[model samples]
Structures are given as C-alpha cells and as structure tokens.
Target chain A: MAAETKLFGKLKTAEQEHEDPKEQLMFDPRPREELNRMVMEMMTTTTKKFWLWAIGLGVGVVVLLFGAWGYMISTGMWVTGLRRPIFWGVFIVTFVFWIGISHAGTFVSAILRVFKAEFRRPFTRAAELMTTFGLAAGALYPLIHLGRVWVFYFMIPYPNARWLWVNFRSPLVWDLLAITTYLLSSTIYLYLPLVPDLAMARDRTTGIRHSAYKILALGWRGTEAEWFRLRKAIQIFAFAIIPVMFSVHTIVAWDFAVSQVAGWHSTIFGPYFIIGAILSGVSAVVTILYILRSTLKHMDYFLRPEHFDALGKLILVFSMAWAYFFFNDYLLGWYGGEAAVRQILTLHATGPAAWVWYLMLICNMAVPWLTLWNRKIRRTPWLMFIITLTINVGMFAERYTIVPLTLGHQRTPFDWGVYTPQPVEISIVLGTFCLFTFLYLITSRLIPMVPVWEVQEGQVAHTLRKIGKAEVPTVTELD
Target chain B: MAEVSIAEKWGLVVDQDRCTGCNACVVACSMENNVPFTGEDNVAFGRGTYWIYNKRMWEGEYPRVAPAFQPVMCQQCGSAPCEPVCPTFAAVHSEEEQINLQVYIRCIGTRYCANNCPYHARQFNFQDPDIPEPMNSYLNPDVTVRSKGVMEKCTFCVQRIVGGRQTASAEDRPLRDGEVTPACVAACPSGALVFGDLSDPNSRVSQMAQNERQYKLMDELGTKPKVTYLKGGGRNGG
Candidate 1:
C-alpha cells in the first residue's frame, strides 16, 4: 500500500516533500548525478588564492623542516632553553597534543558508525581526514626531538659490522614498533571506506582528478561482491582499529606514565590520556566542520545546525568526563601529599608558567562547562568555532604544564631550570601546521568529503512519522 | 619425540635503593640498543622514544616522596598478556625462553598488545627511527633495525640469548643461566639488578626471587612477569 502511494506520489514529488520534509538530509530525493557533480566542482574549482597559499605553505614547510632541524642538529640541544628541570619541553607536548587531536577522527568515525549515529554520515570523511594528517604531523616531533636526527635508526634493532646487540629491552624500541603499527593500520583504515567515493570522483572528473581517483578507487564499481568485501574489510578494521587507537595513545601515555616523573607517573594515565585525546580531538572536529561550512561552497547544504547540535552534545559529555579524570588525578596526588606533585600543583597556580595553568583551566574546564550548557550556543556554528579554538589552546597549555613546566620543578631546588625552545623548534611547529593544512587542503579536492552512499543509506533508513503533535526524525538500522 | 623445555623464567631485579638516576643506564641502553636521544622538547611532550626511563617522585610541601629513580622496562611475564592479544603475533612470548619479543617485520603496529598490557611497558614506532649515518654504523649487527609500522618492546636481549646459546653449543656445555643480561642490568654500576633463570633454584636470580620483598609490577593484574623489585633494600635487609 505504501509503495503504491509512493509511486503515485512521484507525480507530485516536490509537492509531497514540501508538505512533509520528514526526509531532511537523507530521503529528500536528489539526482545522484548532481550530487556527484557538486563533488567534482569542489575538487576542480581551486582558485588563484588557493595556489598562492599552497605555494607559500610549501615553501615554508621545506625551510622549517630542513632548515631549523639542520641548525638544531649542528648546534646541539643547548640552543633550546632546555635544562635540568625542564628537560621534556614543547616538542613532547606538541606530540601529545597532535596525537590527542588525531583521536577524534577514529572515535567519531568508528564508534558512531557502530552505534549508527545518523549525523556521522556527512562528516565521517572529514573526521577521518584529520586522523591521517594529524598523525603525520604528530609523528614528526619524535624525530625533531632527537638532537641528532641522523642517528635515530639506532632505535631499530639492526646489526652491522659491529658485533653489538640491539637490546629489545628498551621501551623506546617498543614505542618504535607500536607507532609504526598504528600509523599504517590507521592509514589502511582511512582508505578502505574511501574506495567507492574515490570511484565516484573518478567517474566524474576529466584531468588529474580522474587519474588520481582512478588509481585510488582501484576500479571499484560498488557491485554486491565488491561492496560486501569492502564492508567486511571495514568491519574487521573497525573492531581491530579501536583497540589500536586506544593502545596508540595509551602507549604514548606510557612513554611518560610508566616512569616516575612527578606529573607523568600515574596508573590512571592510560585511560586518562585516551579520554583527554578524545575530548580535545572532538573539539578539533567541531572547529574543522565550522571552517568547512564557512569556507567551502555548498557545505551549508550538507552541514546543518543539527549536525553542530549533535556534536555539541558529544563535546559537552566529553568535557564532563575529562574534568572527572583531571580531578581524579589532582585529588589523588593532593591527598598523597607527594612533594614533587605539590610543587607541580603550586607552580601550576603561582609559578612562572602560571598563565598557562589558568588558561588551561579556563579553556578546558570553565569555558566548556559554562558555555556548552546552552543549546543555542552549542548548535551555533560561529560560537562553537570560537569555543573549539579556545579549547585547543587550553589543551595545549595543559600539556605544557604537564611537560616542561612540571619538568622545571623537581625535588632538587638547585637543579631546577626553565625550558625555552629555540627559533628552530618554533618554526618547525609552524611547518607541521602548514603540512597538516597542506595535506587537508589537497585531500579536500580529491575525495568526496561527504560520503554520499552513507547519506543515501541513512536516508533509506530514515522516516518522519508524526509522533503526537510533532514529526520526529526516525532512523532504521540498515545493517 | 623429545620433550622441550621452553625457557626458564626470565626476570630483572631492580634494587631501587641503589639507583642513582645518573642517566648512565639511559645512555647505555640507548647506545647498546640504538635508542635515539630525543631532545628535551620531545621528552617534555611525552614524545621521547625512550625504552628505559629514570623517574623521581615528590609528594607534599614538607614531607615529599624523596626522589627515587627507577629504570623500568617490559616485565617479560610468565603469563604475558601482551602476547595473547596481538592479532598478528607481532608481539609474542616465547614460553621456551620466557622472552616477550617484538617481531618488527611482522608487526602491523596495531598496538593492541600495548593497551592490554597493565604495566604500560610497550612503545610504538610513531615514526621511523632516525639513525644518523655515522651512528647507524654503531648499531648492533645481530638485531634487525625495525621500520615505521611495527610494535616493539623489551625482549630480554633475545639476540644475546641466541649468541650465548651458540657460544654454549660451541663449547659443548649446557647453557648456564645469567651468562646474558640486558644492558640496563649490565650498566648498573651499583650491581642492583640481577638477571638469571628464575626456574633454576641455585642461580643468584633464583635465590633473590624468593626474597620477602619480591614483587611484580601491577601484580594485581596477574601478568606473572619474571621481573621483580626489591624496594628500598627490603627495609629489613632481607
């Protein structure tokens, strides 16, 4: 009966939709060809400014990565402000911060996908993009931190003419292995779902985009078998990658936690770091979505206030969880009456780097706690934008306190010294940002940022049935 | 068919009271194992790829937990949890030798083993190891330097075990335990750490294992690690 009515309704498709826009993002019919065309337009439409910015960033990256690093290698660690107390400085902090940012991508894409969150359909690719690029940027800090980048291979258990042994007993070696596993697995995870979208792009384009998509798409035709295999592969990866994601950050946390550093040593750090990563990372996603909507053409059609609102709910939840962990860590340390930990706490409040401490509290705790409570504020794109930016800065400050500032104050008062990075360190950080942007900007053009099939799948599963007085958006599980 | 004894329980005993936190162990471990010296920036950000860490703790204003430096590594456990959960067997435990080993070539860097591990003792190769040319020359020839995508952890010096085994065979003597020790244990000037076959009742490590202060890290999780710690010289001097 419904099928017959829907067939009859085809004659008045527009009229029926106007009468009941119950199928908002998904079922509101669109020519698959037109949607495909929009993706093509976004890719091929890069303007003069894009090229200029690209070139400028390109130039900046090479110089910063090569030039500054070259100087650090030649001069040694002294040029940087690192000393006895503040040994671990900005490099390590940036590493954690970037890794934290990377967490949002997998969490949003995988967990939400598992739960069938409809809002995740449009922005999953955008979030996934953050994972690959963010990891790439985060991975650089370890190399840069090596005062001598050239000899880093020693971490590899390789034997040469020397009869010496590569001791597998080092956590550094464990780290070397674990990160490699994560980066490759994540890249593969990011690529699996992207194949069909690439095929879609491949079919629409003519020049370079066509070739790029053709290679990436791997001749995907979305046949039942192909889709079946892709889905299976995705399922395996989703279940597999979640643990890997948790481990990657946890291992990263262990890089500090397993040791006895005042701030670094904590049994709770494994979950704590993972949670912190997700919180900051989700905020980053909000910021990215806001930028994409404001800057990219036709993004508003795809990204709506509803999406922002849904994400805001997540941010609010994550904020509360992060505070819980933060307080847990503080309460235990404060109660234990550990002198080094107290010094860290007092220094955090009234030390030389006190500004960073307050900024961290305000952005991470107060701002998110107070501002995100309002539904209108949470859903409002510009407001979310400002808040997300503030949160990132705040998270960075938090990491700074945990690392260098905490390092600055130890049991020995005489050995304490403040850490300051050289110009090289600062420039390289700029370079990493540029590299991330460069990669994201490049990716924006090639792959369809929006997963159309997912949206279509969502549409097929969704219906607006009248519930009492108002029509509520309803979804069904396609899988 | 011959019955095979896999390995005697491999363990490291850290005498915390003796550790000076002089960083000699850190440097020695890096030099012996090709650990890179990541700068303070990386270390501060928790990006340091250090496999061996020297740590200190201070508690309150007047009564601080005075500095206690400890060199912590993978506790190659009798019931190694990291081994069972690895999807690819990238990280495996040789029950024969009681070694928690990382196979870099096979490792896809899933890091699941790392997360399941309660000790937080594992590390991932976030980036390719940065070995300078001259320094690369200094790397041990026996072990295979790993690539970018793998999970790695302390193996209790497996290569050295292989070498020691070969030497023992060449001399036609049964392999005596304690012939090989990890760089961290070997480099300790204070002789605080003792490595040997825990299964063997007569070895020094075996005798030390029965001490009253013997405790495994995160013992509540039941990792059953070979490594034990004699905290603060066992106060009673056991």
Candidate 2:
C-alpha cells in the first residue's frame, strides 16, 4: 500500500494535482431530492433587480420595437436608411444576427445530446431556451423589413380569394418554410425533456405556479413506462433536430446565394453560413452561461468552469472552421476573375466601412486563435464571456459586410451608393436585443433552467473507483 | 379568308449620338405616367422615382473631355432577371404586348426584384406621391398612381399600347406602324427614340434595329433585352 501510494503520487501531473475531480458537476454527486429543491428555488426566487430589468426591457420592447415599427408601417420605408442599391439594410443584418444566435441552442442541446457528451447534462436546457427565443426575435425581421408588413401573409401558403400561390422558387419562400420548421421542431425538442422537470416543479409547488406546471407537465408520473417513453422521445428528437437545425441556416444562406448579386452569388454560402452560425451560436451559449452563472440563484453550482472550458474548445474549433470557409470564399472570389466581385471584395477592405471588415477578421480569427489556445484563458468564465461577446460582435460585422456592404457595390458603378443605418433602424435593432433578454429572463424564472433529472441521472451513472491508491472517476452507461 | 397574325412584339431603338442630353423625354415620361416628383433632397439621396433617366458619362481627360448622355430605361428584357425572384408575381410579362409589366397592386415590396435587376431599371415608391396643388390636376387618369411600398418601372407605355389596340379594334383594321408611340418616344426632340412593332418586318424599329452598330446593354447576361442602342460616336450616319 505504501509503494502503491508513492507510485500513484508520481503518476499525477502537476496540473492534475491542482485540479479537483469534485469541481466537475458529474463527479460531484447530490441527492435527487436536494437537486430538485435547488432547481425549484432558483426558478421561484426573484430579486428586485430582476423585476427592474424586466420592466425596463418590456418598456423598451413596446416603445422601441412595436412603437417604431408602428410608426414606420403607418408612414413609409423611408423612415429607415433603405434606398436604391442598398434596399436591404440593418433589418436584414439584425435578422441574420438573431438567426445565427438561435443556432446555439439546438447545436448544444441536440448535437451534444446525440453524442452523449456527459458535460452537456446541466446547461442543455439553457442553450435550448436560447434557440426558441432567438428564433422569436429573428422571425420578426422578415415581416418587419417588408414594405407592406400587413400584406406579409401573402407569403404564407394558404388559400386566398385570388388563388395565387407564393412563388416556391423564391428563396424567401424557402426561408419561411425552413424557419417555421426549425421553430416548431426546436420548441418540441425543448419541451420533451422538460416534461419530467415540469412534473417535479408541479409536485413541489402550489397555487398558480402548480396549475401552470401541472398543465405543462402533461401529467408525467415518472413511472418506468413514462421514463421509457420520455427517453425514447428525447432520443428520437435529438437525432431529428440536428438536420432541422442545419437546414434553417443553410436556407437562410441561400436567400443571398441564389440572388444574381455579384458578391452574394456563391456555392460556398451554405456550409459557410452554417459554420458561422455555429461559431456565433456556441459563443452565445458561453455568453448566456456566464450571465446565468453571475445572475441566477444557484446557477454557479450547475454551470461550472468545466462547461466553459469545453465550450471554449468548441468555439476555438469553429473559429478555425469559420476562418477556413471565409478564406475559401475569398480565394475563390479573387481567383474567379470577375471584375465586379473583385471590386466588391476590394471595397470591403478599403472602403469607408473598412473598420467592419477589420473588426470581423480580428474578433473572429485573431482573438480566438490567440487567446482560446491557452487553457487558463479558456477555463476562466469571465474571460470566456468577453471573448464570446467579441466574437458575436465580429459575426454581426461579418453579416453587415455580407448584406448591405456587398449590395452597395454592384456591376453598375453609376448606381453604387453607401448605406447608413437610420435612427429608427438602430432603435428597432436594440429593441429586439431587449426582447430576447426579456424573454430569457421571464423564461428562466418560469421553467427550471437546469434539467435536475438529467444531472441526477448523470450523477447516478458516475462513480469513483479505487484503483491502487488512486480514485479514478468512471461513468457507467445509463442507457 | 381571315388572316392569322402573330402577337405584336414591341421594341425601342435609342440613337445615342442624336440624344442631346435634354431632359424632355424624362419630363414627358413623368407627366404621362403620373410619376410623383420627389424633392431635390430625395433626388440627391438616390431615392428619385424616375422610370427613365440619362446616365451621363464623361470621356477623355479634362481638356479633351466631352459629356455623353445615355438615356437608360427599362430594357424590357425578353427573359428578365427581376421576374422569378419576386415572392409575389408582381413583376410579370405582358402576353399581348410582349413587354415586362410591374403589377402595382400585387407588389408586397420585398424589394428583391429591384435588387435582382442588373439594369437598375426598377424603382420603389419610398413614400406616397407628393405631387401637390396644380401638379395633381394633370395626373394621368390612364395610369395607376403607385403608392408607397410598391415597385414601378417603364412598362413600354402599356396604357398607350392598350389605347392604340382598342382604337384599332374599334376601327376594324390592323394597328398601323408608328401609330403607338410611348411618351418618351413621342417627346424626343431629335428623333433619338423610336418605338414600333419589331415583329412586323416592315416596321421602322425593325429596320433600325438591323443597324450594324446597334447593340444591347449587358447582352452577355442572356436577358435578351428588346431595346437596342445605336453606338453614340456618329460612326453610323443617322
């Protein structure tokens, strides 16, 4: 035993010696009842600050989002900075930005769940919530950016007096179908795993909260049959949602790709947009996780540095992948020898909006490549928050470059013009940001942000085995 | 025996050398189409609603330079880029006249069609027509006044086409060559603009379009534009 101790002591690296296995959420086991109580408390408890923020954001949504939209709808599209040559402005940019953010939830929850990544146990619900809200914010832009917002129903496939079907060939029609499919599938995916937890909340609460949870729980009893069905449903959705998630962004990419616009017409846009969406989405997950950890009650226990570390690695890989596609797009565009495309590419770097291009490259490529490689930086929650935020800012600039910037310069030099976002557009964009945060805040308080049963199930499967003098953490297959 | 006739395919020819850069055609088009005149600020901001405008280009160094004017309107392509991208069938082709049509009431104004137009011919009504006082009195009753949030463009003067066809049908005879002239063609002082039926082999536009110097703008795009331009340098005598 003495020799075994000496050998085990020598086997441990300096980094491993400092790292405690207990710091990992999986290794740190908590009783099922205690875990349930903690999640319930987190949902039920709200501070004065939370109400203040919710009210402020609510007012912002009404005045800035709906109010400005109402004014624009009554007046004209001239309220925005849209004119000829730059027909699509900040509205389309913000639309793509929100859609990119929505990609995070499905990617983290569905993709990681399918792979059975153990670290994804606690924060999958948080990420999944982002998917739904991000979509809610995003799907508004297609209607909001229209010149005739009231007539937006014309795009929907339904019987009309005119009997005119929407042109299925248009990419916008494809976008409508794809986004609708994604939103419905993602919402169902979010609710399926949530059923068991809603039942837990239903049991622990009474009054109005009990009634709400009771309806939402769908009468879950946690019996063996129910568990079997729930697991099977989750497994089926996890696989199904992955492709839906992929197609949503790919169809969005096609909106620009299928156009005859010189810079936007490219085959690389499909995979390029998907990679970009994932990069921005995963970064958003990290940003939200940091916010929840700092703001929510007991979120620190659920969302630890280990999760941040894992997500940081993902952001780094996606950043690299994003850079690859970006370079590939540039190389092909430059090599193709199209004069208009070459001019647009050159204008992007050297034009008046050159700062946006530089910002995109620096934040998306330079910052992540330089910083995320370091283990300490990746593991630091606060630092990850800032890096991920910067990456999102970079992604926004990238979309800005892709949309209005590219549209600003076309084959006709006589018509080339610059576009600036007007005050109304800026207000509307800020309002959507507020709306997303507001939705998340309200949702966090209503639903259990952490799936307690999933975490507890993870804990049941995880145990420390004594091998010689070492206690090695092992996971048994729960499935 | 009654004769069988093919549909009339309308065409236009612009003789650039004779185009004096005068704004008569533009003014006449605006008056005839009931196009709203946006103020100077809006015009300067690239929000002008002109369906036909001259693209002015300067040739040579400052000392040797001369101003050249190319009056660009809708090419009225045989196969237009702006048609299929529209979510609604707002931009469609006229079967009888063989011209592109912008259905004002049908346009939901996504502006996708405007973006797809390589010629930059299509214009959006950013706001309701602001023509005030006596200007509104002369508004053409034949044309539909487009409101804010819809696209409008040169229709090859479809109202005039319909009027001429109606007159001919009532009189019980084939429509005469040079009988149906668009406002811009009728208003051209130097006779630079010609409008006629290209399908009629004996029509003036058909003969003019056979000029060796005549070429369509951006013809490589395969849009098959019906408006042909005779090169501006007086290389071919008028």
Candidate 3:
C-alpha cells in the first residue's frame, strides 16, 4: 500500500515536470470577452505609421494600377510589351499566381475545417480573407488583358439582338464559370462564420460602428437554434466549395493544357496545378499569420507557436508534393521524344529564362525541405516568415516560366521570341499586391481576425488527464 | 442554281520548286486585304502585321549555304482548333466557301485563337492601323480595315470570291474554277501558287495537291490544313 502511494506521488511529480498544457492555446484558454477586447484594441489603436503606410498603398493603387491601366487603354496594347510568340505575358502569369494564392484560403479554411484540424481555429479568418481578396485581384487580369476592355461584355453569356452567344466550348468560358462560382461561394463561406463574431462586435460598440456591426450581424441573439443552423450551413458550404475550388484551378490549367502547345499539353496538369496551388496558398497563409502575430498586440495569446509549427509542417509536406508533380511533368516532357516538347523543356532549363527556373527550384524545394524539418525553426516566427516569403517568390517565378517563357518557344523556330514586360505591366502587377494588402489591412480593422467562439469551443474539447504513470493530453469529439 | 450545285473545297498549292522568294505575294496580300503597316520598328519587335510572310530557313554552311523560303499563310484547316476556343464566334468556318472566316467586328480580342493556332497564322491588330500619308490613298475599298483588339488573317481574299460568285450569278452561268483568285496567287511572279476548288477533282489545285512532292505543313498535328506545299526549293539570293 505504501509502495503504491509512493508510486502515485512520483507520477504526480513527473506530470508537473512534463510539458505544460498552458503553453498550448487549446489548454490555456482566454475568456471570450478578453479575447474580443484584445482584438478590438488592435483594430482601434492605429499608429501614425499605419496611416502613412495606408496612404502609400492608396497612392500605389491610384497611380500604379489604375493609372497604368488607363494609359494602356488610351494608347494601345503596344504600350505593354506583349508581341508575337508571347501574346500572354506578365498579366497571365500574375493571374495564375493570384489564383494560386487564393487557394491557400480554401485549403486552410474549408479542407482543414472538414478534417477537424484544431490548429486552423485561430487563423482561419486570415486565410479566408485571402481567398476572397486574392480572387478579386486575379479576376481583374482577364479583363485587363482584353484589347477591347469596353467590349468585354461580349464574353458574358447573354442573349443579344445580334444572335451572338459566348462559346461554352472555350476553356476561357469554363474559367469564367469556375472562378465566379468559387469567388461567390467562398465569399459566402467567409461571411457565414463572421455573423456570430459580428454580433459580438455589435455588443461591444456604439454610434456609427454599432450601426455598421448591427447590419452585418443580422440581429443575432446567439440562440441555440441560430448556432445549430449556422453550423449546418457552414458544413454544407465547406463540403460544396472544395470541389468548386478544385474546378477553378483545374479549368485554369485547361486554358494551357487543352492547347496543343508543347509544354502545356500534359495529362498531369490538373493534379499538378492543384498541388502547386495548395503549396503556394499554404505558404502565403503562413506568411500572413506570422505578420499578424508579430505586429498585432495580444495575438500571441491566441496564435501560439503550435499553430506556426503545424503550418510549417504543412508547407514542408506540400513542398514535397509540388516537387513530385513538377518532376512528373518534366520527366514525361523530357522523355516523350516529341521534338517540340524536347525543345521547350530545354529552353525552360538552359535558355534566357533559366534563372527563374533555377530560383523556383531553390525557393520551392530547397529552402522548405532544409528548414521545415526542424521543429524549432518552424516555431520561430521570423524564420518561418522568410521561408514562406521565399516560397511565394519561387511560386511566382514558376508561373512566369510556365506562362511566358514556354510560349516564347514553339514548334517552328522562326516564330520563337523572348518576352520582356514593359513598364505598364510592371506597374499593374505591383499595384495588385498593394491592393490585396490594403484590402486585408482594412478587413482586419473591420472584423475580428480571430474566431473567439471557435477557440473557446476548442478549449472545451481539450484537457490533460492522469493515466497510469503518465499524464497524457487528450481531445474529445466536440461535435 | 449552278453555284448551289457545286461543292467547293477551296485550297492553295504552293510549288516550292518554282517559287523565286521575291516577296511580291506578301506585298500584294497586305495591300489587297488592307493589313496595317506597323513600320520597321514594330517589325523588329515581332509585331509585324504581315498576313502572308516568307519563312526563310538556311541549310548547309559556308560556301554551300542554301536559303529556302516557304510562303506561310493561314492554312484554313478542315478541323480548326481555333474555332472551338474563340469565346466569341469570331473564328468560324464557311461551309459554302470551305474556308475559315474571321469576323473582325465580333472579335473581342481574347487571342486564345491565335495561341491555339500551331501555324501562328493569326495576327492581332495591337493598335489602330495607320496607313501613313501617301499610302492611305491606296487602301482597298472592298476590304474593311481591321481595328485594334481584333484578330485578322488570310481569308483567301473572301471579297474576291464573293465578287466572282456575284458576277457568275448575274451572268446566269456556272462559276469558272479559276475565276476566284487570291491576291497572293495573282501576284506570284513564278506561277508557283494555285488556287481552285479542290472538290472538283479536275481543278489545277486538285491535280497539283495530288503530286508526289505535295505535303501539308504540320500534317501529323491533324489540323488537316487546306494549304499544300510541294517540297525541295532554294533561292541562291535573299
């Protein structure tokens, strides 16, 4: 009996020395009111520097994006560097890059939510916001790429007096349909989870802010039935939007793949694009999460090191998947013995755009594989930020190589020409980045960046309990 | 009634053996179709709006070097990949003429059709055409000048085909096989280009298309281009 008592006492002591559950956000839960107050402070407490940056971004949008577009329209597409052999240049590349960035939101929010990955709880809103804004940024390019932006209404399917109809057989038409479905569905999905949080914001404010939140909140009293219905709707959206998300990028891939163009005609393009989208998307989410945690006060309490660690692991896994798809795509093209395919692959590796090709490898494959394997490095916020930022640069380079450089070379050597983007294209591309960031910054102030109710629910399901000689962590099925 | 009874499969046969690579056909087509003159600077930058251009390839080396010129233009394929990919119905096939017709006013300038064309035969007017001062007076009245943001290509001079058909109908006679001639065929100094109804089986282009040396460029791509080329030709001079 004395031996048993001593054993129990030793076990208890060992448990005390073990890793503290308090270190985890799930175990160390903050009061919902406290979390709300912290977020509110972050939004309300704006510094002079924030204003300066906001004004700068606003100027960038006005001058660079809109100004360049206006100039292009007034002058001609000649003001841009698009010419023979490379008709689709930087605009197309940026379009695909933005679409890939949008994928991060769906993968993190919808897919993780379906799988019940608890780490997604604190930063799902940040990821979801990316989907909505990134898509908006991406959708702009197709219209901008049009030589007759004024007559873009022709692409829209409407019964007209001229008896004209949009060609549904075109991949661009599929692209229009798929992207619209994704953008609308995702916006609704992003808004569904925000109603309860908006209700929370409404209760804690007054005056103009109060009225704004009041409308956004839809007069939610947080009834049991309201919560029940919200849960059901979110689940339906979560399941439905995943396929839409898949179709959007796949259709984009078809824009290239359906053509008999050498580098583009590949059976592997669908999965290749989806995996690439997730990789770029997850890296973007990780970068944004780190920025939020480092810059925003009291975010340290909600977005703990565990979240970064999980995201880092995801980045690493996706990096491997992207590398696999890339290799599968390249190997077939290299060995297929098609002369045009061989020439394109050769140009991609050793031609004028080879620098971008190599950078894509170093950034997407080398950096993540070497750094993410260490848990400590993944937990380190600044380091993870650099890693993710590198991944984004690499992914952008990959798209550029795929879109422009591949188009530069063709079956006939006579038409082969190199593409160099002019000033108008550069300005618009930079402007889109500023637009995305500006929208995100504004969104952070308007809504709670963290879902407080979800976090509290997560805390409820997680606890540490004693079992034999050890105290192990356990999670109960909350649903 | 006679024109309706005739099934026309319009095609071109380029006799490589007879071509002198003089580039007269290029100028003729450009003038007749009212193609935009983008000038030397734009041409250097790969924005030249030539509807039919010479694709010159140099073979051998040093003293034995030989230059071969192939007059490449819109192939007007039987199974066009560009037709299905145009978001607007700008690129469509004319069953009566057996030719690909590019509707300038309908083209929204997506450029998807241009990208899909393996031959790189399609051209886009990136800017509103400028005929300069003196060249403006020489513009063809029959063909509409293409505007910026619209794709235009060799239509086998559809205006001429229409005019010839009208004349034949007015005269109440069967249209002669050789009555319709594209500007390129008329301008060919070496009599290398033949244009006629391939469906007649007795037309000159049909007989030339059956020659042992006759082959379509990128035939294995299954585009089934109507323009046939007779192999083996060289010009000692550029």
Who wins the lDDT comparison?
Answer: 2
DockQ score for candidate 2: 0.75
- Residue-level lDDT of model 1, residues A278-298, one tens digit each, is 989999999999988876777
What are the DockQ scores of the candidates, in order? 0.04, 0.75, 0.77
The parts of candidate 3 lying over 4 Å away from their true place are A1-19, A465-477, B1-6, B233-238
Could you list the CA RMSD of all candidates, in the order they appear? 10.8, 4.2, 5.0
The total of clashing pairs for model 3 equals 0
> In model 1, where do residues sit more than 4 Å from their true spots?
A1-24, A27-29, A157-169, A465-472, B1-238
Model 3 is docked with a DockQ of 0.77
Docking outcome class, model 1: incorrect
Report the lDDT of model 2 for residue B34.
88
Report the error of model 3 at residue B58, Å: 1.2
> What tens digits encode model 3's per-residue C-alpha lDDT throughout A1-479?
22321321332232344545666788887676777788778767777877887889989988999999999888879988888878899999999999999999999999999998878998898999999999999999999898888899888898888899998989988998888889999999999999998998899898999999999999999999999999999999999999999999999999999987879889899889999899999999989988888777778777866788899999999999999999999999888889999998888889988999999999999999999997767867778889999999999999998888998998999989898999999999999998998888778878988887788778878777789989765565667
Q: What are the models' TM-scores?
A: 0.66, 0.95, 0.95
Chain A TM-score, structure 3: 0.94
Mind giving the per-residue lDDT tens digits that candidate 2 earns over B1-238?
1222347899999998788889899999999998888889888888998889998988668897877788999999998888888888888988878899998887898998888888889998888888778877899999999988999999988999888887887777888999999999999999999999999999999999999879998887788999999874745432
Q: What clash count goes with each model?
A: 71, 0, 0
